[model samples]
Each structure stands twice: as structure tokens, then as C-alpha cells.
Target chain A: MSMVSLTVNSRPLRADVEPRTNLADFLRDSHDLTGTHLGCEHGVCGACTVIVDGEPVRSCITYAVACENAQVTTIEGLNDDEVAGELRAAFTREHGLQCGYCTPGMIVSARDVVLRMPDASEHEIRVAMSGNLCRCTGYVGIVRAIRSVIVERKARGAAPRADLRTALGPVGSGHAGAFAGGADKTADAPPARIASPVSRAATPRETAKLDADFVPQTSFPQSFVVAHPVDVVWDFFGRVDEVAACLPGASLVGTPTPEHVEGQIRVKVGPMVAEFQGVADISRDDARHAGRISGSGRDTRSNSATRGLIGYTLTPVEDGRATRVDVSIGYTLTGMLAQFGRSGLVQDIAGRLVSAFVQNLEARLGQGEGAPAAPVVTELNAGSLVYSVIVSRLKELWRKIAG
Target chain B: MKPVRFDYERPVEIGAALALMQDEGRVVKIIAGGQSLGPMLNMRLVQPELLVDITAIPALKRIEDTGSDLIVGACVTHADFEDRRVPDVTAGALAGVARGIAYRAVRNRGTVGGSLTHADPSADWISILSAVGARVILRSASGVREVAVEDYMLGALAADLNPGELLEAVRIPKCSASARWGYFKSCRKTGEFAHAIGAVLVDPDRGVFRAVMGATETRPILVIDRAALFGASGFSTGAAEEVAQAAGMGDLLDRRTHAVALRRAFEQADAA
Candidate 1:
């Protein structure tokens, strides 16, 4: 626990709070101020809006420890406030609420809108209150209530509080003293409940079902050229162990057979990291110089699972002196990581991951047989993450295991 | 959702924050307004061992008007710009853009530097700041370096930050009397991540006619050759098609939205 001193609802309070405890949790759980609501713990849903240093902020995302020496006010604190009082009456008259779960935050945000833009039109009021989402009333009653309050307040000769905040930094920041010696209070605090790391080999593999007719959620194409001839590159593709070594962040559980292979691949994209471990099936057609590898894996940490199918064909270029590899990857991702992985960003990360894999493959091919494999790069190149590395490794491992 | 347990340190000095970042073998993240990083942290997408809060640093909160430019501290909130709490050098360009970021509550705590350093392609600052030719000043234990906002973001969620380096301030050049700026973003709902963003700054006095096609899933595509971009009339749809193609936008709808956004921005600038 860390010692944090702040004023809550005009009352000076000091508490020993864990750094992970957000402002809403500290208010509701620690101080019995349960007026603040949490709809989505992220900043997207503004249900946790509360007054911090006279400015409203998302309490769910703002850590309590960061609000040291700051003034915070919850919905319960606004009982006697003028604007809130008027809003309460208007909301009741306009039927602005249905369930009232989002009322606390809605009122907090609505109060800010009233003070900041008193003369805001109906459209402007809607735009200003867009952050706070209400499932009921379709926002018809809510917008009406706010507009009525604004119209009445403007008629009362009230002016906009545009300059309510005069400080520079974030609303609740710049008021606290620096914690000496990093987190000194955390040292004396009891050990936190942390999730234990999942061991790779020991954990039972809840392998996803893979089949020939499996369809993918999304797919993209990627290609790269190697300086070596098609036959040489094709021969290199036959060695599954060697091929696995060429790809970054891929490792096998045991020796692979022609029909099935099992392994794991760790993919990192920016701050997110996922290690997927599972099994796959390999198939090849020599006449077409093409092959397909289909597999599925799960990242136990995020509880995200991915099933992918990669098909590759080697075609001769530069009169057989060089080889071009055409790869098509299709994948289905479902879970927490998928929720965060925007589609465009996934494609970008996959594109970069493919280029990095090609570089590693070329380097490995440059070093002839019996020579030590190129240095193992456990991390993807250029800070990339997602399906490409995982798919590419599946293709490479399938080739070696099947050969 | 609650974030993973992590140690917190509120450092009042940039040097102290940098020192915390320099701690080898520790996953350290710098938290300013905790607007962008907060969501990621709550979702467990980013789990750091220690969070170094840089908002209390007085130096990072200092804003100065250099007559020709506004050197805004990294911790300056978007609301600060929206309310003109700090001097604005871009006329109302900064304030206009600030008013549209997220919402009033988000602007209350979202820092300008935090948005830039987070480097979300859909964010407003990267598009408008790059169009305005703003330069970001980065500070580290080694020294300070200034990089153009256009070149600051390497990719999505990736800023060109060396280890221990933090963006200290943004140097936004003042708009001349003849300067005209326009920015348009396409979001299904107000304050949501924009699907397409178009920003243009045409300043004859500054000899800058820069247009940007932003929210491209990577770096924003910048076009400095106004002749090739604009025809004798104004923004040309033909040129927009080429720009969209060059940016590798394959979806026809996506390309059309970006083109229309640019066209609207051009119209807005013309009206200005």
C-alpha cells in the first residue's frame, strides 16, 4: 500500500492504497462512496466520471495513487450543488433516466457541460455529452434535460465557466510530492495476488480442432524472394527443424512427423504479448510445388485462441537462379487480444512480421549446410506482433515435419 | 476491469523519470495523463512493472510563447489548449482540434504529449500537428533532440523513442495572418476513433502548403507538393485517388471516405 493524501467530497482524507486501485475503486470500496459507477473499466464508457481538482475525469482509468494531493468529488458530493440540483429536477421532469445506473456519471458529465457551455445548442450539447453512454431513453430525455437546464440557466444570466481550469498539467496531477526511493510504501505492503506464469511444456494442451474444411475469419497475402534457386529453397523448406530455426519466436515440443506437428510461437505487438501453443496438420503437393499447413493455438494468458491456414508456393525467378515465395495466410482470432487488435493494425503488424521472417530465412539460406544456424531471434523484428509470425512458423514447421 | 498490480512513482523532475526508465531489466512505463495508456492498462494489454508518473514535473508543465512559436510542455492538457489556458500560436487551430478530441472530460485530463507519444493513427494531434509543421522535442539522459512530428511516429503505437527518451514538449509554429487551416475527421460517433482524417495547412507567408491523409493504419501520408495534390481549382479527386492508392488503401469505401474528407477539408480551408 502507498500513502496518498487527498480531499474527497470536500473532506481531507489519507489512505494506504495499492497502486492498482483506481480512483473509482478507492472511492467505492475504500471510502464507501459508491455513487461513482463503472460501466466499462476502460475510458471508452464515461460512467465513472467524477470531479478531480474541479475538472471531471474518468475515475475508472485514473489511478488513486496518481491523484495525490488532488481534490476529488463524487456524485454524492454534488447533492447540494446548484447546477446538479437543477439538473436533478430537470432529469426527473424529462424522464432522463431509466435504470439510473449511469445517472451518477451522466449527471457528473452533464454538470460539466452545463458549466462549460451554458449556451450550448441542442446539437452542441449532444456532442459534448457523447462520452457518457446511456442504454435507456435513447438520450432523448437526457439531451432534453440538459438543454432545458442550459436554456433556463442562460435566461438566469449565468455565464459560461470556460476558464474553470487554470492549471497546466492534467487536472489531478502536479499537486503531489514525489514518492521517495521509487515506491517505498509498496515494499512494506503485503504481496499482491498475481497470476502465476504458465509453464510451456507442463500445461495440458487444450488444442483447438483443426480440419480441412475450416474457414478463417480473416486472411491476407504476403510474398518474399530469396536469392537462392527454387530447388535449393525448396530443399531448405523440407527441413522442419531448420525451417523453425529460421523463424523468430517459434519452437517445437518434440520431433515432428509428416502428418502432425506441435509447437508454440510468441507474438508481441507493442505492449501486448501472446504465446500460442497448439498442434497442426501438414500437406504437400510436389507437382504444383505448393503446400498447405493448418493449425490452431491458444494464448493462455489472454485466453485468446487462433486457428490459421497458410498455403505457399515456390516459383522460379531470374531463370531459376532466384526463387519467389508466394504465401497466403488465413486466420480466426477470438478472445481478449482480438478485442484490442484492430483489423488494420493487425494487417500492418502481419506485413512487417512477414518481411522479418523473409530476412531471417535468407540469412539462414546464405549459410550453407553443417554451419551453425543464424542467431536465434526470439523477438519479432521492428516491434511487430500478431497472426503473420504465428502463421509463417506454422507453415515452416509443417514443411519440415511433413518432409 | 482493474489493471495488474504495479508499483507507482510520481517523479517531479524529468531527470528522475528518465532515471527510472533507465533501470535495466525492469518494465517501466511513463504515465502522463493516463488517458491513452489507461485503457490499455485496464485491459491488461500493457502490464508494466512500475509506472513513472511524469505529470508532477514542473518543467514538463511549463508553456512559453516564443513569438513565432508556442513551446507547449508535454504534460499540458488538451483542455489547456481548448480553454486557451496556454498561449496558442496556431490562431484557433489548436483549440479547434482540442475541442474535438474524445470529449470534455477526456480533454480535461488527456495530455498533448501523451497523445503524441502514444502515436495512435486516429488521434488528432499527429494529423494536425504534422500539417502545421510542429516539431517534438525529446529529452533523455544523453541529450535533447527535436524531430518533426511527421517523422516522430514510426508505425501504429510506435513512436521513434530511444530507450529513456521522453517527449518533453511540442514546438508548434505560429500561423501567419495569411495562413489557412482545415481539418476533418470521419467518425461514426462523436469522439470515437476516426476512420479517416484529412488536415491541410496552406500558409503562403510560411511557404507551406501541406496536406495530410491520416488514420491510415500506419504513418500519416504527407503531401508537400501542393501542385500535384491540388489542381487549378482546389483539391482534385483524381489526385486524392492517387494519394489513397499510394498509401495502400485498397478498400474502395475507405479510399472514398478519405478522399471526401480531404475534399471537405479543402472546402473548409477555402471558406476560411
Candidate 2:
């Protein structure tokens, strides 16, 4: 056994824990903090919700020794907060409880939601509370209770007592009392009113501001500058063999056309190998007066389909020494990919593919000879001039060596 | 259900932690947040003879933002990333994924380095750190060595961390201003282990993108590109099918689910 010191809900606790003791077990079994329940012994269930340093997490899945010197908060600690009280009241008034097994976890989770999202909507609240499951099928009422608090708080310009009571119901209301039963019994004390208003539920504006703090922004315009004539760059880009060489783990097959290009692309990524037939539309961007490519294809291996549009604009820079290239791509998912919508995983894969393409192009261009040391300008170029020069030189050398 | 008996140590410093690890050798396990390892212990998946608790090592808890990179100690919990005091690039992604880690209690007890060391394929940090091109700092009796995040992850529940070595901190380069990044995961539920995860960063100005996909396998699948060929039909078809084949989705228990995940990954990559 080892002795470790830590703070739990503002109280200092010193306990002798075994090396294998989990933090959730220590809290529930040793300290008797039953407010933190165990749903999945694994990390899945949000049932064992507890605030560790202000963030909520599963207690059942945490090891006790890992929390040495940490500040921990269970459902017991939230009793003193006005927002928790309001959520409790709203839960009761809205009949957010049934058999009540999941209530403690729900309350702890709800406390986090209220603190983070005072003005959360019914849908946002539902999404935020999705981690906590209620077998009693009381999610509708639970959502209403949470949303009611938000509506009430927003109307009053502060934490409103009426909203809290209306959303949760008055203290001692049947449903509210039942959910509070375990907490009250564990504390062995009567519920007391909190005098501070500063601790009121976070309003919608506050939650929105908070949401804005973390939401990723998409602000960059997709554009690049290449130093070659538009015709030369376009010719190289139009060649399937040359394009294939510039793509990692890719091989191109078949012929090209003005409206569409058809071929087989064998691409290997990590442990997976995909062999698929692809077709794309090549067109002229009339508005931006650039080259526009758009089309859709399918992966025969997974039977997944992909669709996208790419716009490219080329401009002369420093004579014919360099050309600025701009590329923009808009892609959509269908078939199997649609299942992963809104999960955030799709965004990650898209980013990787784009990055790899860029790196491959850079490497391929770096290998070309007499690629201008300085930037160049060319009105007729399709790609970067320096890159085109290198490619052209390499082709010439290959031809001379073969001859 | 109580935990089985085992030896424990509270190391006051990094040297003490390393010394204890050296003495105990493989018999000892180092604990940080205890989020992932704790459940393993409770399940008896790992029964170490001695546990060296490095929480008392103050040096392992610091987050230093140097001009070029951000250095984070091993003992730094996900909550530490939520502190406004931390840098925006590090904090934003950390908080975003950390918030999805089970719930509040787990995040409280979980440490940043611990999750990476555990190398759970479904873990958020694995994919995120891998995509960002972070570096892991390891300390042993011999000295300290650094490994790139991509090189550190060996496989499922496997890492390049050697014996008698303890992870001290992680360093991540500051993202370029033109970088547009995104992270996505598919799980049975919001807080559950991810079925698949992808992390991506795109530099539109530089015409480059970097991506790492995790959970479909033990280590992350890395890809880099400049030509934006993925947006082309042929490349998209080839890449999507390739991902499916690489993941062995057809033989998977839930082939449909896996296929969906792979397709989504491809679409997401194109979108990014």
C-alpha cells in the first residue's frame, strides 16, 4: 500500500491505496462518494461522471494513484452551486427522472452542461448530454428541463430562481427528491440555499462565446504559385504518367479526354491497398478564367464513392521564371462515408490526402534541372515555371541517355 | 471489487522516478493520469510488482511554450490544456479531444503522456499528436532521447518507449498561420473508444496537407501531399479503396461499419 494526498471537493484526503486501486473505486468504495457511479467498468459510460479540476470525466475508468495532488469533485460538491440547484429543480419539474438509476450520472453530467452552456438549445443540450444514457427513456423530459433553465436564465439576464425551480421543480418534489435521495443521504445534511448569484447557470451567450473559443475556423484561401507557362504546366498535369509519378503510392492507367479522364489508380496507404477505376472532368474556369476539374469515382475494394471539384488559377510572376498557381477543392462523401458524418474523422483524412499531394509535388519539382533560382513571370503558364523547367530537363536527359 | 495488492512508490523527482524504474525494471509500471492504466489494473490486464507514481515530480507538470515549439510534461492532465494559460493551438485540440474522453472524471485523472505511451489505437491523442508531428521526450538512466510521434507508436497498445525509460514531455512545433486543421472520430457513442480517428492539417498557402489516421489499426496511417490529387476522381477512388483494403475491412467483424468509416476518412481527407 502507498499513502497519497489529494484534494476532493475542497477537502484534503490522505489515503493508503494499493498500486492497483482505481480512482473511481477509491472514491466510491473507500471514500463513499457514491455520487460518482460506475456504469461500464470500461471507459464508455458517462455514469461515473465527476469533475476533476473543473472538467467532467468517467470515475470508474480512472486509477486512484494517478490523481495524487489533484482536485476532484463529485456530485456531492455541486450541491452548493446555484446552477446545479437550478438544473436539479428543472429536472424534477420536467419529469427528467424515472427508475432513477442514471440520474446521479445525468445530474453530474448536467452540471457540466449548465456550467458550460447556460443558454444551450434543446438540440445542443441533447448533443452535449449524449454521453449519459437514461434507460428509463426520459431524454425528452431531461432535455426540456435543461432547455427550460436556459430559457429562464436568458430572460432574467441572470440566474433566475423561477427558471431553476420550473426546470428542476422545487426541492422535495417527488422526481427531484428521488434523484437527490442518494446525494442527501450521503451528505447527511439538509439542502441549504446558496446566496451567491455569481455561480448561476451559464447563459446562451456565454456558452456561444465558449463554443466560439474552441470551434476551428476555415479561413485560408486555397491558392499556390508555380513558375511555368499555363500551357506547359497544364500539359504536364494532363499527362497521366507524370501525375502518377508525383502521387505517393499511386499508379495511373488509361487515356485522357477534354471532358473527362479515365484510368485505374492503384494507391496504397499504410496496410491497405486499393485498386479502383476513376474518371474526372477537366474544364475551363470561365469566371476565374482558370482550369477547373471536377468529377466522382468509386473504390472497388470498399464500394465507396467520392465526388469533388478543383479549381486552379495560374498567374505570371517575374517574367517566365515563375507562375503563381491557385487550387481549391470541394469534396463530398457518399455511400459508406456518409455513415461517419459529423464525427470529425472525415476531416482528418481529407487533410492528409491534400498534404501528401503537396509534398509529393514539391519533391518531384525539386529534382528538375536549372529550375530557376529566382521567381519568374509568364502569362501563358499553367503551373510553376521552375518546376516545368526541371521536368523538361529531366525528360531531355532521359531521352539523350536512352539514345 | 477491490484492487489486488502491489508495491507502490511516490517519486519526488524525475531522477528518483528513473532510479525506481531501473531498480524495479519491468516489474514496475509508471502511472500518470491513471485514466487508461487504472482500468487495465482493475481488470488485471497488467499486474506489476511495483508502481512508481511520478505525480509528485513537479518538473513533469510544466508546460513551456518556446518560440518554435510547445513543451508539455508527462504528468500534465488534459484539464491543464483547458487552462487559458496554455497556448491556443495546443489547448484547442487538447480540450476538443480531451472533452470526448469518457467524461470529466477520467479527464481529471488522465495524463497527456500516459495516453500516448499506452498507445491505444482508439485513443484521441494518438491521431492528433501524430498529425501535428509532435515529439516525445524520453528519459532513462543513460540520458534523454526524443522520438517523433509517428515513430513512437509501434502498434495497438504498443509504443517505442524502451525499458528503464520514462516519458518526460512532448514537444509540438507551432502550426503555420496558413494551416487549416481538423480532427474526426467515429465511436459507438460520444465518450466511448473511437472506432476510427483521423487528424489532418492543410496549408493552403503552401499547397500542402498532412494527415494521420488511427484506430483502424495499431499505429497511425500517415499521408502527405501537395498537388491536391485526392480531389481528382481517380485519386479519390484509388485512395478510398486503398484505405479499405489496408484496414482489411472486408474480413472485419463489422464490415459495413468499417467500410463507412473508411469512406468517411476519404471524404474528410478530400474536404480538408
Candidate 3:
């Protein structure tokens, strides 16, 4: 726990809170200020909007410990405010709310819109209030209420509060002293609990969605040439264990047969990491030097699941001295991670993954016959891949700049 | 969603923050505005052992206008830019871009260095700063180094940061009076992460006409060739397509959307 001192609704309050306790939870749980709603704990939903140091902020994402010595005004604090009074009257007259769940946050955000952009147009008001979502009224009534407040306040000669831009950095920042370290005693604390594994019963749809011959939502092709012959590469692919070892962040959960294997692949993209655990069905054809692997996996932490199909063929290249491997991957991802989908980002990460796999595969193949496979990588460090890719990309960019 | 329990430290000095980063055994992350890291932490996307809050660092909170360049501290908020708390060295270009980032509520806390270091490909600062010819000042306990904005972000969520180093400030070359800048981003909704971003800065006095095609899932495609889009005729879509194609964008529709964005930004610049 950390000690945080702040003035809440004109009252000087100090509390000891966990570093992870966001301001909304700090207010609701500790101070019993339940007016700030939490719709999406991520910053996407503005239901937890509150006033901190005279600027609106998302309390759900902003930790209370970070707001030391700052002033916080929840919806309850704004009861005596002039703008809130007008907005309250307008909202009631316009039927701006029905369920009243988003009222507190809506009022807070709407007050800012009125203060900042007093002369804003209707379209501008909609754009300004886009962060705050009101499920009821289709936002027509909410827009009307805000617009009415702006017009009425303008007629009353209330100038916009252009003076609120006082702080230099983030709101509620710069009010605290240097680090005294965490106030919580660490010697007697217990070990943190391990996260519980995701239950399969929770997501039957993920398993049901994985079927043979099912078309993938998105597919991309990648080809790489290695300094090995086709027959040698083909033999390596046949050994599912060796192949799995070649792929970074992939490890077998159990002993695998020629036709079936169970594995987990941990994929990291930027800050997000997902470890997908599932089984795969593998098939190969000797004549065509081609094979296919289909599987589905789910990451328990993010509750994101993916169904993927990988098809590859090995062809002799460079006068049979080397091998050219052509790979086509199709996948459909769903759930929380997929909701922030950037297929281009996935492709970029996949390209790096394949490059890493090929490098590992080359190293394994050069080990000669009956050699033990290289140590399996438990996690794919995308940061290292990004670094390697950047070095070359930088040279090209500099060259372009020179020209 | 809530973040995993972690120790927090609010360092008041840059040296102290840099020292905290030297603890190699612990995964320590430097947090400025918490606008970008906040959401990630709430979702447990990044679970660091210790969070070194650099917001209270006095040096990083200061912004300086050096006649020819604007030295903006890493902790200066987007609202600081949007509200002109920091001087507009780019002839309102920086303010215009700052206003469109996330929203007013978020802008109140999101910082320039935070957004750049976070290095989301779709983020506005990377594209605009790169176009306006900005360089970031990186500091570590060892020493300090300067890197061009184009070289700052290696890939998505990847900044070219050495261990124990923190971005101190961004040194943006003040645009000449004759400079014309335009930036446009396409999003499904207002204030969302952009799908396609196009920013162009043509400063004949400064001998710089740069075009950037951002939100490409990696380092943005920087078109340095002036004739690729900014010809004697001002702006051309044919050149935008050629530049996009040369960047190896194979998707026809994707290339077209980016080209259109570039063209729109170009037109916006041309008008300015």
C-alpha cells in the first residue's frame, strides 16, 4: 500500500491504497462515492470521468496513489457547481437520461464541453462528447441538453473558462515530493497468488468455431529460403516435435504422435501477451512434399481465442543445394484481444515470427543427423525481433533521406 | 479490469528515475501521463514489478523555446499543447494535432514523449513529428543522445530505447514561416486509434517536403522524394499511389485508402 493525500470534494483526505487501486475504486470502495460508474475499465468508456485538478479524467484508469496532493471532484462533489446545475436542469427538460447509470460521468464530461467549447456547433458538440457514451436516448437528448446549456450560458454572458489550463504536465501531477519508496511493509507480506486458469466451459463457442475446411477470416502468405535441400527440410517437417521446437514460444504439452499433438504458443505483441493452449491435427503427403496443420487455442488471461491453419510446401531451390519453403496461414481470432484488431500488426508480427522460426530451423538442420533439437523457446520476445527489424529498416530510411 | 499489484515510486528527479531503471533484476517501467500505460495496466497487458512514475520529475515538466527549435519536456501534456500552454512553434500545427488526440479529457493527461515512446503506429505524434522533422533527446545515467523522430520508433510498441535510458524531451525544429503542414487520420470513430494516417509537411524555405503514410502496422512509410507527391502542381494522387506501391503495399484497397488519405493531407497542406 502507498500513502496518498488528496482533497476530495473540498475535504482534505488521506488514505493508504494499493498501487493498483484506481481512483474510481478508491473513491467508491473507500469513500463510498459510488457516483463514478465503470463501464469499460479500459479508457474506451468514459463512465468513470471525474474532475481532478480542474480537468476531467478517467478515474477508472488513473490510480489514486498517482493523484497525491491533488483535488478530486466526483459527481457528488459537483452538486453545488453552477454549470452542473444548469446541465441538470437541461438534461431533465430534454429527457437526457433514462436508466441514470451513465448520468454522473455524462454530467462531468458534458460540463467540460460546456466550459471549454462554449461557442461550439452542434456537430462540434457531438464530436467533443464522443468519448462519453449514453446507451439510452440515442444521445439525441444528451446532445440537446448540452447544446441547450451552452446556448443558455452564452446568453447569460458566462465566458468560457479558458483559465483552467494552469498545469503543465498531466492533471494532478507535480503536487508530490520525491520517492520515499512504498509505505507498505514488504517483509511480512505473503506471496502473490497465481492466476486461475481459464475454464473451457466458459467459451464453448471457440471450440465449436474450429472445424476442418472452415474458411479463415484472414490469411497471408510467407516464403523463406534456407541453406538446406528439400529432402532434408521435408524430413525435419515430418518430425512434429522438431518442427515445434523450431517455432519460438511453442512447446509441446504432451508427447505427440505423427497425426496429433498438443502444444502452447505464447505470442507477445507490444504490451499484450497471450499464451494459447490447445491441440493440433497434422497431416502430410510424401509425394507432394506438402503438409497441413490445423488447430485452435485459447489464452486464458485475455480470454482471446484463435483458430489457425498452416499449410506449407518445400521445394528444391538454388540447384538443389537449398530449399524454398512456402507457407500460407489463415486464422480467425475472437474475444477481447481481437476486439482491438489490427490485422496489419498481426501480419507484421507473423512475418517476424516466421523469420525467427526459419533461423531456428536452419540452426537445427545444421546439427547433422540424430542431433538433439535446440532448447525450446518458452516465449517469443517480440522486442528483440523489433530491434533486429529496425536496424535494417533504419539503414533504408537513412538511404532514402540521403537521396 | 484492474492492474496487478506492483510497487509505485514517484521520482522527483530525472537522475533518480534513471537510477531506478538500472535495477536489472526488476521489470521497472517509467510512466509519465499514464494515458497509454494506464489502459494497458488495467487490462493486465503489462505487469511490471515496479512503476517509476516520472510525472513529478521537475526537469521533465519544463518546456523551452530555443528560437530555432522547441524543446518540449517529456512530461508536457497534450492539453498543454492544445491549450497553447506551451508555445506553438509549428504555427498551430502542433496544437491542431494535439486537439485531435483521444479527447479533451485524455489530452489533459497524455504527454508527447509518452505517446512517442509508446510508439503506437497509429498515434498522431509519430507521424506529425516525423513530418515536421523532430528529434527526441534521450538521457541515461551514462550520458545523453539525440535521435531523429523517424529513427525513434523501430516498430509497433517498440521505441529505440537502450536499457536504463529515458526519453527526456522532444526537440522539434521550428517550421519556417513559409512552411505548410497538413495531417489527416481515418478512424471508425472519433478519438479512436487511427486505421490510416497521412501527414505531409512542405517547407520550401527549409528545403523539406516530406510525406508520411502512417498506421501501416510498423514503422510508418516515409516518402522523402519530393516529386512523389509534392510536384510543381502542389499535390498529386498518381504520385501517392506510386509511393505507396514502392513501399510494397500489395493490397489494392489498402493502398487506395492510404493514397486517398495522403492526397487529402496534401490538399489540406496545399490550401494552407
Q: Chain A vs. true chain A, TM-score per candidate?
A: 0.89, 0.40, 0.88
Candidate DockQ scores, in order = 0.49, 0.09, 0.58
Ranking by DockQ: 3, 1, 2
Clashes of each: 1, 69, 0
lDDT of 1 at B30: 89
Candidate 1 per-residue lDDT, tens place, B78-100, comes to 99999899776775788888999
For each of the candidates, what fraction of the native contacts does it recover? Answer: 0.60, 0.19, 0.62
TM-score of chain A of 3: 0.88
What are the per-residue Cα lDDT tens digits for candidate 3 across B112-145? Answer: 9999999888899999999888999999988999
- Candidate 1 residue pairs in clash (backbone atoms < 3 Å): A240-A400
For candidate 2, lDDT tens digit of each residue in A1-403?
Answer: 5565667889987776554566667787778887777776655556777765555666665555555666778788888877778888998899999977778778877876766676677777877788788878659999888888778778878742332211110011111000000111124332232212223212111110111122222211354455555555655565545555555445443456656565544443211233434566677654444776665555543344556566677766778566666666565545432432222333333333444454555555555633422212211111232233334433543343233
Provide the lDDT at A6 for model 3.
Answer: 83
Task: Please give, for residues B147-234, the per-residue lDDT of candidate 2 as tens digits.
Answer: 9887676544556667778889999777666665667678766667777676766656545466665675445655554222255443
lDDT of 2: 0.58
Q: Summarize candidate 3's per-residue lDDT along A1-403 as a digit string, tens digits.
A: 7667889999988777887788999898888889989998887779999999998998987888888889999999998999999999999999999999889989999999999888989999999989988888899999999999999989989978966666699998888787557734466653142353444333442333447667889999988998998999988888999888888888786699998888778777655677788888889999999999898888777677788899999899999999999999998888777865578877877877887787788788888889966743435664565566556555655554445
